[model samples]
Target: MQTTTLTSTWPQTLCDPSGRRQAKPRNKGCTMVIDKGIGQHAFADMLSTSGEYIDIVKFGFGTSTLYPLPVIQSKIALAIKHGITVIPGGTLLEAAVRLDLIPGFFRQVLELGFTGIEVSDGTINLSRTLRNDLIRDAKSMGLTVYTEYGKKLFGSRIDVTDFARTAEQDWACGAELVTVEARESGKGVGLFDEHGECREGDLSHILRVVPNLDRLMWEAPLKEQQVSLIKSLGPDVHLGNIPVNDIITLETMRRGLRSDTFELQQVPYSEYMI
Candidate 1:
C-alpha cells in the first residue's frame, strides 16, 4: 500500500516557535500513538483532525486480538489510508514467539492489513540471533519493522553498552527504529525513575553512544516526560506511546505553542517594537 504525504495546515510564511517541525513521511520527529481502545468514529475523528502530525498508531499490547476481525481490518486500513503505519504491539510478537506460532502470527497480521511490525521482548527473554532474524523476516515481508529495547519490570534501567550494541545490530538487520521501552505508564522503567522522572545521565549516555539519534524513538507517555524529552533532545526527536487524545497538544508543544516550550519560538520584529 502507498503511504500518502500530508502537509501542515499552518501557513508556511509564519515562523514556528520551536523552529520548523518536519512534515509527514518524515524520518525524524516521528510520533507513534498507543491506542488501547477507541471506536471507529473516534479513530476517524482523530485522523481527520491531526493525522498529519502522527506517524504510527500501535494497537497496545494484545488489544488488537480482542477486537473483531472486521474491526481490526478496518482500523488498520483506515490508518494506512491516512499514511499512518499501523501495527500490533510487540507483546503480540512475544506471545507468538513463546507459542512457536510466529508464522501464523505473521500471516494473520498481514491478512488483517497491518503495514508494520514491532519486535520487542520487554517481558520475554529473546536472544540476539532471534531478534535479528525476526527483524529481517519482517522487512523481507515488505513491512516496516520497529524493534524496542529494555525490559518492562519496574526499576529495570537501561544499560548503555547493551543498548548501543543491540540498537546497532537491529538497524543492521533492517529495522527502521530502535524504540526505548518505557511501558504505557512511563514510570520506573528504561530511562525513567520510579517517580516518572527522567534519569538524565542515562539519557545523555544513550545519546552519546547512538550518534544517529534519529534512529531512536523514546516512549514518552506522560506529559512531563514528553516535555522533558523534547527539551532535552530537541523538538525533532521521535517519540512513541503517546495517548490518542494528546496528539494535537503534543504537536503544539513540538511547534512551541505550549507554555512549557513557548520560549523555544522566535519573536517577530514587530513584537520587539512594542
Candidate 2:
C-alpha cells in the first residue's frame, strides 16, 4: 500500500499558474504516460520514484498484447496502488474491435486490473459515432475513458474547429480527457511540426476555441516541446507521450526547477530588472 507524494518545493521564481485544481488523484490537468514495454522491476521503480507526477500510464500501441499476462496484471496493480490509472493503448483496442475481440479485450483488461481505457483512432479509422459508442461502453464498464484526437501520420494537421468539436463531444460522452496525438516520435503530427516543435498558431487557435484546456493532453515526447508547452500553458497543462527516462525531468520543468522554464513568475516590475 505505497503512495507517492508531491513534496517538491515550488521555485520562488515560478508561481503556480494553474489557479485552483485538485493536487493528486485529480480529474483535471492529468499527465498520462505512454509505456513502451518496460519490465516489471523498471515499472515498479518508476512508480516508486516519479509516480506522483504520473496520473495515467498507457501501454503504448500494442505492447500490452505482447507482454505476458502476469506482467501486465502486476503493472496495473502497481500503478493503481500508486493512485495512477493504467490501461492498454487504443491501437490494441482498435485491433480488438476490428477483429471482433473488443468484448474479450475489455473483459481481459478488467480481469488484469486495468483502471482506465483509451479510445483512439491513431492507427485506424473510427467513425465519430463508433468512437462515441466506445467511450460510452468504456465508461459503463467502470473504466476511466480517455479519448484521443488526431491521426498518427506525418504532416497530420489539426483543424482547430474539429478538435474543439471533438473535445466537447467526447466530454459529453463521458471521456475523462481528450488526448492530442503526436505519436511516440512527437513530430509531424497534431500541433507539432516535423522537428518536434509546436506550431504556436495552432496551439493558440485551439486554446481560443477549446472551452476547458485542462481536459486536453498534448503528447510531447521531447524536452524542448515539453518546456515550450509548459511555459505557454502553465504547469498544469495535461501532457502525454513522455519517455520513461524523462519523468523526473518533466516534473522538474513543471515546477520551474529546470532552467528552461525557471522564469515563469517574474514580477511585473522586478527590482532586479528595474
Candidate 3:
C-alpha cells in the first residue's frame, strides 16, 4: 500500500534527522490516539497537521455516544478518508454487554460509520467464551476487532499466563490487535506500579510468552511511559491511549527526533581522528 510519508519533502539530500520512521499503512510502529472530546474543526486541524502519524483514532469511553449521530458519522468518515481506523472505546462495548445490548451496540456503531471495535473487559468480568464470541461477531460484521487484556481498576494486575492465553485466543478468534490496559491515567494498573513506572518483570514475562510484539498495543498515556516503551521495545512497538495533541511529538520520538530517543539515529563518531 502506497501511503504518504511523514515528511513533506521526501528524497531530500539529508535523511531524517532522527532516523527513518516507517510510513503510513504500517503494520508495526503503529500509534493509536485517544480522543475524549474534539469537534470537527479541531479534528480537521489535527489530521491536516499530523494525521499521517496516527494509525487509529479511538473515541475514548462512552463519549462516542455523547455527540449527535451526524457529528459522530462525520468524524469517523473523516478519519477513514485519511486512512485511519476509527474505533469507539472498549468501555462502550463493556456497557453494551452489561445491558445485554451487544447486538444493538454493534449495529449502531457500524451504522454510525466506525470501522473498528474494541472488545475489552476493563471494568467488568468477561468470560473467555463471551470474549471469543464477541471477537467472532465483530469480525463477522466486517469490522476490525482490537481486544484488550487488563482491568480498569487502580489495583488490578495482569496474570501473565492468563494474559498470554487471552492474547493468543483473541488473535486466533480474529482480533487485529490486543491492547494491555493502562486506562487514561496510566497508574497502578497493568504493567505499571503506583507511580506509573513499568514493572519490568511482568513486561518481560509477557514478552517471553508472546515472542512477537507486533500484536500487542501498550497503552502509554504518559510521555514518560511512551518514551520508556519506545526505548525498550524499539520504534515499531504499537502504542495506544495517546492524547490527540501528542501525535506529532510521539512520531518525532519514534524517529529519534526527540532527545529522549536521539540515539536511535545512526551518527558518525569523531571529527578529530589523529
Candidate 4:
C-alpha cells in the first residue's frame, strides 16, 4: 500500500503576519468537496492530486444511488486511504427516511464502505427528536456524522438562536461537525443573499451565539464567497460544498497564496519562528 505525505514547509514570504494558518489533521478549517458524478479514473486522479487538502467528499444529493456499485466502492476506498471521509448527501438519507428504508439505507451505506454520514433536513421537515435520532443512529453505526442546518429555499434565513441551540444539541448527540447549508450555487440559502453574497450581520450573530465556531462548516462554493469567509473567520474556519477544481485554489487562499488575502502572508518572527 502507498501513502500520501503532506509537506510542512511553507514559503517564507507567504507566512501570515499573525501566524494563524492551520495544517492537516486539523479539527477546524476543513474543506469538503461536492462530487456530482465523476468517473473512477478522474476521481482517482483528483484524490492523487489534491486529496491532502480535502477533509471530506460529499456525493452531492441522490447522485450516490445512481452510480455503479464498484465505482462508489472504489471512490470510498481511495478517499479512506488518503484519510479523507466520504459520504452521500443528506438529501439521499432523507429520501430513505421518508420511504421508511432507514435500516436498509444504513446497511447499504456500510456495505459501500462509506466512513461518514450527513444528517440534514434541507428539503424536508424533520422534528427535533428525529434529527437527534438520526445523529445518534449514524454515530452508533461507526460513521462520522455531520449534521446540517438551514433550509434550501431562496429566501430562507438562519435563526441565530435556533441554530445555536440545534448546533449544541447535535454536538451533544455525537455529531462530529455541523454544516451550514448554502447549496451548490451558494446563493439564496443559509446566510447568503440572492446574489450569493453572505449576510455579515447574520454570520456575526451566529458566531456570537454559537459556543464553538470551529464546529460549524460553512458551505461556500464560489471564489468570492470563499474569499469573504476566509477574511471574516480567518483561515481556520471550516468550509464545505467546494467544487472539485477549486480545492487547490481554496487551499491557496487559506495559505495566503492568493491576492484576495495576500496580507495574511506576513508572519511575525515572534509568533511562528522557532
- Any runs in candidate 1 off by more than 4 Å, and if so which? 1-15, 271-274
Please identify which of the two predictions, 2 or 4, would achieve the higher TM-score against the true structure.
4
TM-scores, all candidates, are: 0.93, 0.89, 0.92, 0.91
Please provide, for model 1 over 65-146, each residue's C-alpha lDDT reduced to its tens digit, 9 standing for 90 to 100: 8998888888889898889999999999999999999999999988998999999999999999999999999999999999
Clashing pairs in 2: none
RMSD of every prediction: 4.9, 4.4, 4.5, 4.4
Q: What is the lDDT of residue 143 in candidate 4?
A: 94
Question: Candidate 4, residues 1-274: lDDT per residue as tens digits?
Answer: 9887977886555454335555567786899999999999988999988988999999999999999898899999999999899999999999998999999999999999999899999999988999889899888889999999989888899988999999999999999999998999999999899999989999889878899787889999999999999999988889999999999998888878778978667655685577
lDDT of the structure predicted as candidate 2: 0.85
Full-model lDDT, candidate 3: 0.89
Residue 152 lDDT (model 4) = 87
**Winning model by lDDT:** 1
- What does candidate 2's lDDT look like per residue over 111-228, in tens digits? 8888889999888888899888999998998999998899887998998898889999999999988989899998899999999999999988888899878788889999999998
Off by more than 4 A, model 4: 1-21, 267-274
Task: Summarize candidate 3's per-residue lDDT along 1-274 as a digit string, tens digits.
Answer: 8987675665431345555566778898899999999999999999999888899999999999899888888999999999999999999999999999998998898899899999999988999899999999989999999999999898899998888888888999999999999999899999888999998888888888874478899999999999999888998889999998899889878877788988787665667543
Clashing pairs in model 4, backbone N/Cα/C closer than 3 A: 15-265, 16-266, 16-267, 17-266, 17-267
